[model samples]
Target: MFRTRSDKVSLVMGHVIVTRGIAELPAVFFTAIMEAVRRFDDFTEHNDPHGEHDFGALTVSGERIFWKIDYYKRGTEEGSPDPSNMVLTERVLTVMLAEEY
Candidate 1:
C-alpha cells in the first residue's frame, strides 16, 4: 500500500505504514481510514519519545495496525497562541478474505 497526505502539517499528517498482509492493501481499507478521520473533528497531540510531534498511522506485517491523531496548541514565545490543531485519527481495519486450509 501507499501513503497519502491531505494537509501541509509536516508532523501531523500522512504517516502510515503498511503491514499485516496483502489483503490489507486494498483501496477500501484506506478509504475506511479516511472516513474515520473525517468523523472526528478534533484530536489530541503529544510529544513522542523523540520530542517531536507524533501523528499518523502504522501497520505491521502479520500483526496489527495503529492510528495516531493529535491535537494541540502552539505559539511563539511572545505572539498570541494559535487555535487548536487536530491530527488525523489512525486505526486498523481488519478485512477478512477467504480462509486458507
Candidate 2:
C-alpha cells in the first residue's frame, strides 16, 4: 500500500513494515530488498517457473500517514488451481513525498 501523509508514508504487510518519510533510507536497505527479490525469483524459477507474482497498494486513514500493501503469487496459466496462486508473498517498499510536511 502507498499512503501520503503530512510527513511520510507508511507501507505495511503481514509482519513486515517499512516507512518512507521526508528522509532518505539507508542504501543497505534498498540493496537488501533488491537482492532478496532477485534471490526469490531464482528460487521460484527452479521450484515453480510458471508462477507469477504481483504487488499492490491501498490507502487508509484519510489517505494520510497510512497505507497497505498486498503481495501474492499466482499460477502462470490463465486458469489454475494452485493454492500458491492465492498466497501473499511480501511487501516490497513504500514511497513518500520528499518535501512534504
Once fitted onto the true fold, the runs of candidate 2 whose alpha carbons sit more than 4 angstroms away are 1-23, 42-50, 55-101
RMSD of 1: 12.7
**Number of the top-ranking candidate, with TM-score as the measure:** 1
Error of 2 at 23 (Å): 8.3
| Candidate 1, superposed: residue stretches over 4 Å from native | 1-16, 21-26, 34-41, 45-52, 55-65, 68-101
Cα lDDT for residue 57, candidate 1:
38
Task: State the C-alpha lDDT per candidate.
Answer: 0.35, 0.35
Tens-digit lDDT track of model 1 for 46-69: 424443322433333332334443
Q: What is the lDDT of residue 68 in candidate 1?
A: 46
